[model samples]
Target: MGRGYRRVHLEPAGAQHICANRPGARPSFGQTGVESSAMSRIRLAASLVGLLLGAACVPPPGDALEERIAEDPTLLRIVDRGELRVGIPTEALGIGADPATPGREASLTTDVAGWIADALGVEPSFRFGTTAEILESIHGGDLDLAFPLMPMTEGAVRSTKRSYTAPYYVAHQRLLLAPDTTGIDDVGKVCLFGDARTQVPVENISPGLEGIRSNDGQGCARMAASGVVDAISAPDLLLYELEASLPGSRLLEPSYNTEGYGAVVQYGETGLAGFVDAVIARAIDDGRWNEAFEARIASLTELAAEPPDLTAEEAGALFPRGLPLE
Candidate 1:
């Protein structure tokens, strides 16, 4: 169950080249210097032209760009121009999922992405693919960030050129039990399912656990509905969604080992990383992130009960983290 989740930090090497030529000194590129005053003037003019062109092509200052994005951001530059693209696994255990509607996967990630976009003052554009595919895309310069609920591992850090932000949320593995399993009081013996060889108890919760045998969150939810497995052990938020979808299924009282989720950016993008970090910190401070979480959970709860329409405030509040323009 490598699942492309690993803890690795990619640090940038800084300021390697410096010019030694001082003002009023003759320009030299080795032992031989510009031979004639005429040649020197021509070279200076060429250098000025190159400098002007380079300056024109450089990206705007962070604050200026942020303001522009706030005015009217769209997905075009973020997606098509490759300025800021995000990658996530097509389906991962409590982390990523393909929703029937666009931008409606697991609520936590959706809210997180929304906050990040607001912080960047840009619209977010997502690329969904398998874990391997997403990692490949990142390496090939197709993605600027990745948010796959990946576990911190050495290999992941090295492969994706990622620098992870602080943990935003934590989840624990749990067992999803069958409706018929009456006497199953012990949390461990909830009759977990996957392939028999890959299926292991909650004690063995690791990325490798998926290698032994693993079913996705949706698959486990379906299994619980069909009574194939006594219960499924996974992240609580995912379990909550599953239980909401299936009336009879219930999450066990005690959860297993807790794992953390963090935001990751491509290596060398310190500016972008700082912006993301600031936005997440603001989200925590302003209570927007919690609002979004509660709202989504409320919606799920309401849907389980009678599918009532949610207010705009309730839906918007579900994403408290707004983009910071200053």
Candidate 2:
């Protein structure tokens, strides 16, 4: 056992009772001396127990066991089952499922999951879920991995049981403006569509601008159309989808707030995470990731015509070392 760490063994219920033979026993008038002596011994034993408990060592935190579980069962289970169960986002555009393509089973998230599965020598089985549902399903053991290019923002979903691999892509938050509008200066207020990732950067970029929130992107676009809000803010890819929906809307130049997107796994899944990180790094280095992006992702949106800007220095700094931001 490691220093300051000890395993505590618990006795089974009814194995032994400390006071089994002394149920409600007390000093009787006829046997005061005997009862008092017994009581004194009991008090002394209790004091000893208190000392033992006070000096007892608590086991290390759960993360200390991560190395021990480095050979995690998650990857083995997937291999044994012959299917890698992955969770994909349902709301994110270009990456998630699309309505226009019926039974069209391929998107960025799926493609990436497929690549990971290919390495595992199994097929990828996808489950489409919203952000909250994805995190919940991952914790519930219903998903082996979640690949939505989920933004690792401070406001994003978090769990102690969850961990993220190095990011495969990085983007900056941007504003979508009306065709006639010049830039942020021409816009008084912006719609965030109730997403914290967008709201944080938008607010930080222009603290004076009034921020508006709505139920969804469509609702925010409606408000912008009516001149209720001057602009909408989102990631470049998502802003493109919004721009397509609202004709004459253009992406404002010079984006704000850098964010990296990565795959999510259950905590202590070091083996799976290591494999995923290696795969992503290899793909990005070999140009395969860019080709896939252009074919599957950029082809969908006009604004995302170019792949994300991921320099070697940026990749080394953002991923394989630590998360980009808190």
lDDT against the true structure, per candidate, is 0.45, 0.56
Candidate 1 regions exceeding 4 Å error are 1-83, 88-106, 154-160, 182-200, 203-213, 298-326
- What lDDT is reached at residue 249 by model 1? 59
TM-score of each: 0.55, 0.65
Summed over model 1, clashes come to: 20
Among all windows of 10 consecutive residues in model 1, the one with the lowest summed lDDT is 10-19
lDDT of 2 by residue, 208-236 (tens): 77777776778778887888888988766
lDDT of 1 by residue, 192-214 (tens): 43223212355464332222124
Candidate 2 Cα misplacement greater than 4 A, ranges: 1-73, 98-104, 148-150, 153-158, 179-182, 194-208, 300-326
